[model samples]
Target: MFGSIWQYVYTNFLRYWLKWFIRQVTGKCELQRICSDYTPGASRTTRAENSLQASKNKVLRGALKTSRDHVEQCVDQIMKAKNIKPQKDPLFKGSLHICLLQITGYSSLYTSVEELRKEVFSSENPEHEAMLLKLWGLLMPEVKLECRITKQWGDIGFQGDDPKTDFRGMGLLGLINLVFFSENYTAEARQVLSHANHPKLGYSYAIVGINLTEMAYSLLKCGALKPHFYNTVQGTPELKHFHQLYCYLAYEFDQFWVAEQPESIMLFNQYREKFHDKVKTHLQDPDVSLTLTVGSY
Candidate 1:
């Protein structure tokens, strides 16, 4: 009860006075101080975002929702509202512009990812069917699929004869990530598949890939990937960046699963949670860059 009251008091009352005092002492607004004090990337951008969200000024708060094309104008508006002159602080405009881009870009990236996740995989779509075939060819170059709806799908780690049913939970997002890893990191994807085919220690490759997609999606939806994207991509993050992150998860999770040598596939959830926790811990660092690095094929 007291904590809630204190938070309300702090947010509504004490915060503005504190900002006023700090600005008077330092001659810098919260945003300016944020950009100047912290170096670029997540540390600067995340703090700027938080400061904007807490601002009572409409322009400052609205800057968080500014579109990509209008980011420069939004930064101008913020400067005009705050009375920050380019002559006095030349770097502020560019720094704040980049911060706004990262902030708004995170939201935009999530929208794109969510749309893909909601797009159901359809056998009727030629593009979708082609992607599935491409994934098979990439992973299994030596063996041709006997048929589109055969047990060969199981050899690549789908749950049943047909692979389409396995995509129900994650939709097209799952398929795209699976194909992305195979397409970009062919050798690594095939190596992971080989590990998955190890009779006793083997787990379903495609199913687990989809499961890792969910893991990536969850981290993204919760804003846990902000540090990673901000640190890695200088400009706006796109869908391909998200796919690349999935590749990291897919490769790392396979290595993790093999190293542990669990009793059975039934213990997947237990180990999955452990790996999720490990990834979350890494994301807590401001310098986190979760990229998949391996030798070239």
Candidate 2:
């Protein structure tokens, strides 16, 4: 309780001090007159309240501007303090721009992906368990199974009664991609899962799904997917967007594998690498964007 009280006091004092500082810097009349410009008919009390809010907003905008400048200054200072010389070569600047693009994009997209991936993969979470069940139900609607766990997991490609074991490496991210693909394109997901169970060239359904998740994660980590995100997403990318990327991979890989017609599952890595190379080649283009071509064979 004391801790809470102290926190409240500290927060209020800081807010008050910041507003006071802003008022002093901008001058009381200028800050107060901001709202009056557009609110000519407003009552005196209403104008006063508007002036207070406007002053706060002006302070916030000023602080944000300063904060951005401070960040850039700090970066320069750190580089200089470390005896680092700025790049002189044009080629080096181009390379640095590319690197910065990836670094910044990864910072925004990867953090959210990791958070969602962690939350969904934890076996102890009831919400994750429910989501798993829902994913199953969405895929295999005709076959009604009991709420309790059972061998019915095999219907969607798990090796055992409990499917969570399949998510060992990929975490919730794999399952989420699978679910997103299945839920959005139900027929497509089922068709792919059916092909996965083909007797001669069959692969583990959930296992391969998780592998594709890794592929998506790696592309994201190395900045290969930055162009796609930069072009496709207007602002910050989120977990759902990452899942969509996984969906594209899952769908595209199925097509590539079937078209290749490998002799056996033993050749999976070879074919997977080939597909990875193909994607990397595409990323080499400045105009490349990774949009899913649903139902386009």
Candidate 3:
């Protein structure tokens, strides 16, 4: 039903009416919003959830990434000092899960969508596969599993070669930068733009990588790291703003920001494009206007 609805909208209404609807909602003069309209969350089906559950079924449940021991200790301390038993499941499991995924790194996963499709769809592990799909969906809703730079690096390393030299000379940091600034970003591009909340998550997730880019830039500027972004986006003078925003997300402010506004976590990506601008903004300045779409506060 949902797919059919989307199909109908795509076939007819999307090009004509959707822009009007967006204009009504956002009150902006331009029809373009540089960001995907929808993004995944606990309420939405996502690719990340599917991948996460699959990892859990593979007996890697204990391995998800989380904050450092110091952070966990602080959390525990707060719980005890506040006399709050706290919700054990969401806290422990959620933190652990994020951590494990980070440690394993999305790059370390299957090198291609075909591998994931084959592994999960195969009959060898029906229940486990189902679980994996569920988890993956939560993390990356409708995210088309992909392979681009990161996967290229993975393939190189997997074939018993050194990543730095044997791989395409592009590492995670490189892939992260490519995903946003370059129009030629290959791997995750096609999938991210079309999916449900998946696109939104990709935008937000890219923030982490983009921020990493900023740090690499800052550090390099300070003679710390020998890396820099191409620093090119086609339009808008706001690229530097995005650099500042992302740098804050990766290092200085993620934890504090979350702590300060727990209620705003779900709408984490509501403000991304204002800083970085979108592909359309870079390539062609969109002139149509619409009302500003307010994200979750």
Candidate 4:
């Protein structure tokens, strides 16, 4: 037992030390490697040694950003890419699958694709409540919650006076959170509005339906929403790969993670490509600024 405890402690302690070491070394302004802006694989300079120490893994910085900004940028980029009007083609049925493909490191299993459709999406499965609990653990991981086995509380998702509400998936109104909690909780992310109230966050028949009128109005303003919705999923592997990225963006919007992605020349170059002439002509654009920092977490 002592040995096990020692191993556990050693692993966590080492990881903590590793984070510090990476921050200490690369925190300097000299080597400006962007994109993979991280506190890992950092090297310390030594005079006599004439070499820098190395870290095992590297982190990419600046992954998250303000939602409003993200929405606008996404709109601009999508528009600039092409005038391709987004239509709800049957081919792209599983939009989540495409989004999930991008989310590699992040995983919220309780709401896995299967579970999402079954419990959260279709919500026919009586065990959906249990699944929601599991997903909450993965996404929020900060809110402490208790799972009551009995339906004494009535249907899953929504928790309120209305028993008529099957409340399959609540979205913004503390729906997913009816599940579990984690140590790395960012409470500000909590949504006061109900996602079940929005069609974009559609769950099941028992849940609320998205209002087409409001969605159409939103589409004109936010073009990214169309592309996001058009995705159903052509291939499994490729779609799932991107879903992770999509989900991460949907869920996590922390300032700290942004300053930690790979921002190396190569990476930035790609970003530049994505940003196009914005970097070429107006690199000094007002929006441009150094993002990575410590303790923003």
Candidate 5:
């Protein structure tokens, strides 16, 4: 009896005291407000429920000034005190809280994408060469290509002979997204590649895929995809989540192209712009999913 009482009291002490500690260190006014609103004598369940709701309201109102990392740490501390799982916790799983985390996650992801954009993919880097080969192998498992950087790159999807020149704009990020999609969903990736090679409506597969990466990045930056991210993701998003978004765009755009029935690849930009506008409109809704329903096409 005494142990249980002591444990409960100690848990509350930590939860209540940490708010003041956070306020003094971070100077986040919203945390101060949340801490001050705690009602003493409330049951532990009630306290947790109230705190989670208050945090969500603050997040939605744009009143929370605390950084995502700090908030995440706070949640960790609370969960440890309460002996609860993170994903099962009400605070982190709430839509508004996830929305805030998504914002922070997107900022970090965009910075990474920007850094990758600046780096020119080089064959000298063993990792880059390995990834390039892995990408080709994942897409064309049956046909083996030479290890040397040569025109054989065209056998997959590069514009010219050497695939290295093709990474000028999107750089390593584009290649990584392409590789991620192919490695995770080989069949769907091959189908998309086949569509890109259509006799009449054929487009440059790698080039179009990279362009879609730019589009995905742009949507994330402008907050157009917030609705989708906020609702679908129950916790902090990650780089793989961004890559997944790119995969969706790459796959869906191929379907869009084939459906549009354009006369030739010459009309790509026109159809591409149309598809972009459609995505923007979908994002305008507060409940957009934008999930890729890939199948064995």
Candidate 6:
């Protein structure tokens, strides 16, 4: 109770006075210090975001909500409000511009991801069907699928004969990630599929890939992926970047499952939670970059 009260008091009162004192002494705002102190990555971007969110000034706080195109204008407003001179701190404008881009870019990325997730898989869509078949061909190049709704789908780890039903929740987003990994990292995707085909330790490749899609989506939704994106992509992160992150999770999870060697597939949820926790732990680092290193298998 006391700790909570202390936090409330500190955030509401002491924090403002402390920042005021620091600004008076250093002639630099919190955002200025953040940009100067930390390099161009999550460390700087995250701190600048937090500082802007916590500021009493309207322009500073509004910068967080500014659109991607207007980020420069927002930065200018923030500089004007804080009395920051571009001539004096040459690097400050550029650094803060990048930070705002990353911050605002994250929101835009989530919007794109959410739109994809909402797109339900339709078998009637020739494009969707082609992508699904493409995934099978990429993973199982030699084998020919007998029919569209055959039991052969099991070879690639679909839960049922038709992979359409499995995408009810994650929708096209899941299929897109599956195809992205298989398309971009063909060798690694097949290697991971081989691991999934293991008798004892094997798990469903497509199903788990979709599950990891949900994981990636959850992390992105909750802003847990901000650091990873901020560290890796200097500017606005795009849909392909999100898919690449999914590729990393898919490959890494396969290795993790093979190493752990859980007794049976029924233990997947338990192990999935374990893997999720591990990824979350890694995201805690300021320099976390969860890219899948090709040829590492």
Model 3, which residues run further than 4 Å from truth?
A: 1-172, 176-203, 224-252, 262-297
Off by over 4 Å in 6: 295-297
- The alpha-carbon deviation from the true structure for residue 208 of candidate 2, after best TM-score superposition, in angstroms, is 0.8
Tens-digit per-residue lDDT, 40-78, candidate 3: 121111223233343312222332332333434533443
lDDT, candidate 1, 1-297, per-residue tens: 999999999999999999999999999999999999999889999999899999889999999888999999999999999999999999999999888888899999999999999999999999999999999999999999988999999889999987889999899999999998999899899999999999999999999999999999999999999999999888899999999999999999998998899999999999999999999999999999999888352
- Candidate-wise lDDT, in order: 0.94, 0.64, 0.31, 0.29, 0.68, 0.94
| Per-model RMSD to reference | 1.2, 17.5, 25.1, 24.4, 12.7, 1.5
Candidate achieving higher lDDT, 1 or 4: 1
Q: In terms of TM-score, which candidate is stronger, 1 or 2?
A: 1
Candidate 5 pairs with clashing backbones: none
TM-score of each: 0.97, 0.62, 0.18, 0.22, 0.70, 0.97
Between candidates 4 and 6, the one scoring higher on TM-score is 6
Whole-model lDDT, candidate 5? 0.68
lDDT of 1: 0.94
Clash number for model 2? 1
lDDT of 6 by residue, 114-151 (tens): 99999999999999999999999999999999999999
The sequence of per-residue lDDT tens digits that candidate 2 reaches over residues 1-297 is: 999988787666765686568657854343233333332211322233333334434432232223322434433442343233455222322222222233344456776677656653666788887788778887788778775569878767787888877887777777888888888777788888888888886777777888888888988877678666655554345667787788788888888888888899999999989998998887776556677767422
TM-score of 4: 0.22
Ranking of all candidate structures by their TM-score, best first:
1, 6, 5, 2, 4, 3
